[model samples]
Target chain A: MEAYEIVKLARDKKRPTAKAYTKELLTNIVELHGDRAFGDDKAVVGGIGELNGMPVTFIAVEKGGDLKERVYRSFGSPKPEGYRKALRLMKQAEKFKRPILCIVDTAGAYCGEDAEERGQGQAIAQNLYEMMDLKVPSISIIIGEGGSGGALGLSVSSKVYVLENAVYSVISPEACAGILWRDAKKADEAAESLCMTSEYMMKFHVADGVFKEDFSDFKGMCAEIKETLYNDFVQMKKEAPEEIIERRYEKFRNIGVFAEKKASSEKGDID
Target chain B: MLSLTELLKKSKNTIENGGRQFARDEKVKCPACGKEEYRNTIKENNMVCPFCEHHYKISARTRIRQVFDKDSFHELFDNIESADPLEFKGYKRRIEKARISSGEKEGVVCGTASLNKVKCAVFVMEPGFMMGSMGSALGEKVCRLFEYACENHLPVIGFTASGGARMQEGILSLMQMAKVSGAVKKHSNAGGLYICVLTNPTTGGVTASFAMLGDIIIAEPNAVVGFAGRRVIESTMKKSLPDDFQKSEFVLEHGFIDKIVDRRELSMTLGRILNLHREVI
Candidate 1:
C-alpha cells in the first residue's frame, strides 16, 4: 500500500473512532471526566472499564468519525486540558493498580495561542515524567497518525503497538515537507522518507508490535487485540513495578543506536 | 569585519535597518533597535543588544564560555561522529560542514563541568550545527552524560537551542526524544538536579522532551520556546499571533518557564541557584 494511502486510511471517517473502539473492546463502560486542574476535554475521552472481564483504566485521544464530532473534538488535537485529564486518569489507574490502555490518534497537539498560553509544553512534559514512573502497567496503541509529542505524551508505555494502517511520525509529513523543501506539496515524499509506517516503527523498536487489521470485521479485530493485550498483561503482571519502570526506560533508552562494523578501521576500535 | 567606528557612524537613526538582508556580515543591526554594532561587542555583551536589550543568538562555544567559570568546562564526548545511517541526500556533507562550521562533533557538546565550583554535567546545544537538531549522535552523548551524572550524583545543566529532531535522520532522529527523556528520568529518579536553560529558538522535539522536564526551567530573556513555529501556527490557524507569541516572556507568563534570565547574568544566576538547590546528601 502507498504511504500516502496509509495516511488517508488513518484519517478515514468511515473507520471507527476511539469511542467506537472502546465500546467494542471494553465491557461495563463507566465514563470519567475532568482533570482537577481543568474542565473536561472531549478530545481525550477516558473511563474505567473491563477488557475481557479484567479491570482496566482506558483513555484515548479520538477524533469523532462524523463531521460534527470531528469539529467538536478538534480532530483529536488536544489542548493542555486534554493532556491534564489523561494524566489525572492515569494516576487513578496507578493508584488502583489497574492496567492502563491508551488509544493514541491525533494530528498533533493543538498549537493555537490559547493552547500555548495554557502551558502545553509543561503539561506534556509532566505526563512524560509521571507516565514513566507510574507503577501500573501501561500500553498504548497508535490507532492513527501518532504525530509528534501529542502522541508521545500518552505513549510512555511498557509496550506500544501500532495498527497496520496507522502512521507514527515525529512531525506531520506536511510540516516536515514545509520545513525541509519550502514546499508542503512534497508531503508525499516526506511521508515516504519519515519511515513512520508500522513496519518501520516495529523494526526500529519504537513499537512493541503491529496489529494487522481486517477492516471489515471490526469486532474480530477488537477481540484479537483484547486477547493479545490480556495475554501480555498476564505475563507483565509477574514483574515487579520497579522492574517494569526500569525495563520501560531501558526500552526507550535503546531505541536508536547502532555501530556499522567498520571491518577494523585504520584508526582503531577505540577511535 | 567592520570597525566599531564605522558601526557607530551608521547609528540607529542613520540606518533605517531597511530590508537588512545582507548574507554574511560582521556588523549586526539589533532587531529591537536599529543600532548596528560590531559582532564582537555584541558577543562580549552576552549577545544582547546594549541599546535596546534585544537578545541575539550566540554560538554554543560562546554560550559555554560565558556561562561557566573561566576555563572550568572540560569538554568531553567531542569525537563521536554522526553516521549517514539512511544516507539521506547531502546529509553526510552537511554533517562534515557542520563539524567545521560549528567546531563540534554533533549539535551538542556534553560532559562534566562546573558552574562556579558547583560541579554539574553540562550539555550545550549549538544552533550553528544544523540548528542543533538531535540525531543519534546527540542522543547517545546525552544519554551517556546523564548516566555519568547519575553515577557521580552530580547535577545536569543543559542549554538548548534547537529547531527540532534532524529530519535527515528520519526515525533515528525521532527516537532521540525518547532516548534523552529516558536518560533524564533515570537521573531524576536518582535525585539529581537537572537545570535546562532554553536559549533563543528552542522548539520542536527538543522542547517536547528533556528541555521541559527540567527541575528548573530557565529561559533567556526572549527565547523562542515552543513546539511549532510561529509561521506554522499562523498558517494553520489562519491568524496572526501576538507580537510576543512563543517568546520567553510569553512562555514564562504561561508557567512554561520558571524564570527569564538575561544572558549576561546567566552565569551568576545559575551559580546562585546551584549553590542554593544543592541537596546536602
Candidate 2:
C-alpha cells in the first residue's frame, strides 16, 4: 500500500491507530509505556523503532476513531499519566542516545475533572521542561490536529514538520471566532486568519518543513523522511552536549522581542 | 423612558469602546489631580499624570514601544493564520470582521528584540485584538515563540492583557493554560528567565498558567489581575467583595504578584533584572 493509503487506513481504524502506523513505517518497534510516578496513560504511546535500520524513539498521540475506541484512548487527549509516560520514554531515549520522533495529533490535553485532580498541569509542565534538556536529537511531526498543551507536551523538537493538511494552533479556530464574534460559523475565517495549516506554519518558521501530500509512493516518502531525519540528527550531533542544551535553552528564551526606550525614573530600591 | 433607553445605548457604546468616554468627557475629572485634561494625562508623563502621578492605562502598542529598544524589535507569528476546527456557526465571518477592524493577526504580538541592550523575547497581548483572547493560532505562536527562545538561549518577557481564554475554542482554548505554562517551565528550567508583566484585565485561564509563573511577576499599577472577575466571584460565592479585590496592589499584598510597578519604570526594571541573570551569557 502507498504511504498516504496506509495513513488513511490507520486513520480509519477504530483501535490501535499508533500500532498500525508503527507496524507499517518502522522495522523493529518496541512499546514503552507509563510515567513511573503513576499509572501509564494509554492515550500517549511511545517506543523505540528502527527507521531504515537507524534506531529512533517514536512517540505519538493515539486517538480512537470509533466511540468505544475514543473512550478507551481518552479521545486522543492525554491525562497527567499520559504526559508522565511520554517524559519517562523521552528520558530513556536520551539515555540510549537515540533520536526521538514525536507525532502530534491530539486536540488538546485531557481536561477532565479527574485529570485536574491529579495535577495535569504539573505533569505536562514537567515533561516540557525535561524534554528541552534531553541530550538526544528530537523531531516532532503534526500528523493531524495539534491542539493546545497536549500537542505541545510532545512537540519540543529541533526540527518540527507538519503534514500538508495538518493543523496546529493554541486554540481551535472555532473557539476564537465564537468568543470574539459570538458566532462559531466564522471558524473558517478564523482558521484562515489564524494560519493553522502546515503551509502557513512553514512560512512563520514554526514548522521547519511541510511533507508533500503525494504519498502515493510509500517507499519514496519513507526514504525522504529517513533522509531528513538523518540530516537533522547529523547536524544536531555536531554540537557539543552542552552546546545542544544551551541552544535548546536559547530557542525558547528569544521569543517576542520588541522595541522600547529605557526609562530614567525609578522608585526607591526595595529593601 | 425614551431618554433612559438612549442613555443605556450610549453607555453600552462606551463599554464597547473600552471606557474611552471617561477620557472624552470634561466633567469626568482626574481622580488624582482634578484636571479637566485627559490628553494631558496620556502625554505629559507617559500615560501617567505629571501632576498627581496617577497611572493611566496604556495600549499594547504603546507598551511594546516603551519597553523595547529602538528599532530592535522584529514581529514574529504575524502571519501564521488561524482556522476554525469546529466550523462553528458564524465563527468564520466574525473573525474576518475582527481582522479587518483590529489590523492585527491575533490578540497577541510576539517577537524578538533588545531591551536596553539586554536581548529578550517578548509577547504583548493587545486588548484591542479580540480582547486578547487565546485561541489555537495564538496559543501555537506563543508556544513556538517560547520554543524559539529556548533554542536561542534568550530570556522571555511577556506583557499580558487578556480577558482570558477564548471561549469559542471551548476546551481547546482552556488547554493553552497548560501548553504555555509548560513552555514557560521548560524555558525557566533551561536557565532562561521569564518575566511576566501583567497589564489591566489579565484574567481567566491565562492567569492560571504562564501569566502567573514568571520568575519575577510584575503588574502595572491598578491593573485588573485575577483568575475570575469580581462580579462573578461575588455572585457565585455570595460574599461581599474586598476593597481591592483582584486589583494589582491587592494581589501584590497577597503575594500573588511580586510588585505593582508603574508603567514608566517597567523597561528599566526589566533590563536590570535581565542583566542580573546574565550568568547564562
Candidate 3:
C-alpha cells in the first residue's frame, strides 16, 4: 500500500479511538482527572485500572466518538496541561509500582497562544525526561497518528508498538509538503518521502513490532493485544527496576543513524 | 586557510579597542534599530548592537569566545558530522551547504571551557547551521557532552538556538530529542548542574527536550522563545498576536524562563551561577 493510504487509514474517523481500546481492554477502571497544577484536559484521558487482573496505570489520547465529542476532546490535540496530567498519572503509577500502558493517537500537540503560554515544550520535555527513567514497566501502542513530539512525549517506554495502519512522522505530510515544496497538495509525495508507515518504523527499529488491525472483530483483536500486554508485563516485571530503566534507556539511546569520525580521520563507520 | 576558530582568534587579537584594526572597513546594519556600525564594534560589544542593544544572532564559535574565558575552550567532538539517513531529496546538499555556511561540522559545538575560572562543560548551538536543527550528530554530541560532564563531575552550560528537528533526516531527528533528554536526565540525576541559555528562535522538538530541561533556563533579551512558531499559533487562532508574544521578556513574564540576561552580562551571570553551585570543600 502507498504511504499516504496508511496515513488516511490511520486518520479514519471510524477507526477506534483510545477510549474504545481502554474500555475493551480494562475492567474496574477509575478515571483520574486534572494535572493538579492546572485544569484537566479532556483530550488526554488516563486512569488506574486492572489489565488482565494485574493492576496497571492506563493513559491514552482520546479523539472522541462523534463530532460534539471530538470538539470537546479538541480532536485529540493536547495542550501543555494534557501532557502534565499524563505525567502526573505516570508518576502515580511509579509510586505504587503499577506498570504503565499508554495508548497514543494524535495529530499533534495543540499549537496555540494559550498552549505556548503554559510551556508546551517544557511539559513535553519533562515527560521525555521523567519517562526515560520511570522505574516501572511501561509500553506504548501507537493506534493511529503518532505525530511528532506530541506522540513522543508519551512513547519513551520500555517497548513501543505501532498498529499496522498507523502512521508516525516527525512532521505531518501536509506540513512537510508545505514547508519543502510550498504546496500542501503534495502531501502524497511528502508521505512517500517521510517513510512514516508502520513498515518503515519496524525497518528503522523505531517500533518493536506492528500489531495487525482487525476492526471488524474489535473484541477478538483486543483480546490478542491484552494477551500480548499481559505476557510482556509478566516478563518485564521479572526484571529489577533499575534493569527496566536501563533497558528503556538503551532502547532510545541507540536510535539515531550517524557516523563517528575517529580522531585522526574525518569519517568513521556509518550504521 | 585558517580554521574559523583561528580566524576569529586572529580577528580578536587585531581589534583591541585602541588597535589600528584597519580591517574594520566592513559595516553591519542592526536588524533591530537599523543603525549601521563597523562589524568590530558590534563584535566588541558581545554581538549586541551598541545602538539599540539588539542581540545579534551569532555563530557558535563567536558565542563560545564571548562566554568562556580567554583561550579556555578546548573543543570536543568536532569530527562528528551528519549523514542523510533517509537519503531525502536535497538533504545531502543541504548538509553540505550548512556546513560551509556555519563553518561547523554540525549544528552544535561542544567542549570543556572555564567560566570566570570555574570549570564546566559547554555546548553552543549555531543558528547559522539550518537554524540549529537537531539531527543525529547534533544530538549525539550533546548526549556525549552530558555523559562526559557526569563522569567528570562538571556542570554543563548550553546555549540553545534551534528551529526544531531536521526534517530531512526524518524520524531519527525526532528521536534525537528523547536521546538528548535521556542524557540530560542522567546528568541531572548525577547532580550535575545544567544551565541553558535560550537564544533567538529556540522552538519545536529542541524546546520540548533538553532546551527546556535545564535547571536554570535563561534567555537573551528579546529572543523569540516558545514551543510552536508564532506564525503557526497565529494561523491556528486566526488572529494576530501581540508584538511581544513569544519574546524572551514575554516568556519571563509568563514564568517559564528564570531571567532575561543581556548578552554583555551573560558571562558574569553564568559565573555567578556556577560559583553558587560550587562544591564546598
Error in Å for residue A126 of model 1:
1.7
* lDDT tens per residue, model 3, B1-281: 99876565455434432333445369888988998999877778887899899988888877887888888989898778898778798888887777666656789989999988888999999998889999888988999899999999899999999999998878888889999999999999988899999999899999999999999999999888888888888888899999999899989998898999999999999999988887720
Ranked by TM-score, top first: 3, 1, 2
Best model number under lDDT: 3
lDDT per residue for candidate 3 within A89-111, as digits (tens), equals 99999999999999999999988
> What is the alpha-carbon lDDT of model 2 when measured against the actual structure?
0.69
Give candidate 3's error at residue A2 in angstroms: 0.9
lDDT of each: 0.82, 0.69, 0.90
Write one digit per residue (lDDT tens) for candidate 1, span B1-281: 86654444344213312222223548878877799998767766877898989888766666777788766778776666587665566777887677666655578888777777888899999898899998887887788899989999999999999998888877777777777887888898889999999988998888878889999999988779988778878988999998899999998877788999888888998998898886641
Candidate 1 scores a chain A TM-score of 0.94
Clashing pairs in 3: none
**What is the number of backbone collisions in each predicted candidate, taken in the order shown?**
0, 62, 0
DockQ of each: 0.40, 0.05, 0.80
lDDT-best of 1 and 3: 3
Q: For model 1, what is the error of residue A29's alpha carbon versus the real structure, in angstroms, after optimal superposition?
A: 1.2
- Which regions in candidate 3 have their CA more than 4 angstroms from the true location? A263-271, B1-24
lDDT of 2 by residue, B20-61 (tens): 334453433566678756573455457677666676655555
Per-residue CA lDDT of model 1 for A1-271, tens digit only, reads 8787788888787767788788888999999998888678889999999988989999999898778988899889998899999999999998898999999999889878777778777778778878888888889999887888888889989999999999888777787788778899998888887777998887778889999878788889988998999988888878899988888887777776433234453221111
Please give the lDDT score for candidate 3: 0.90
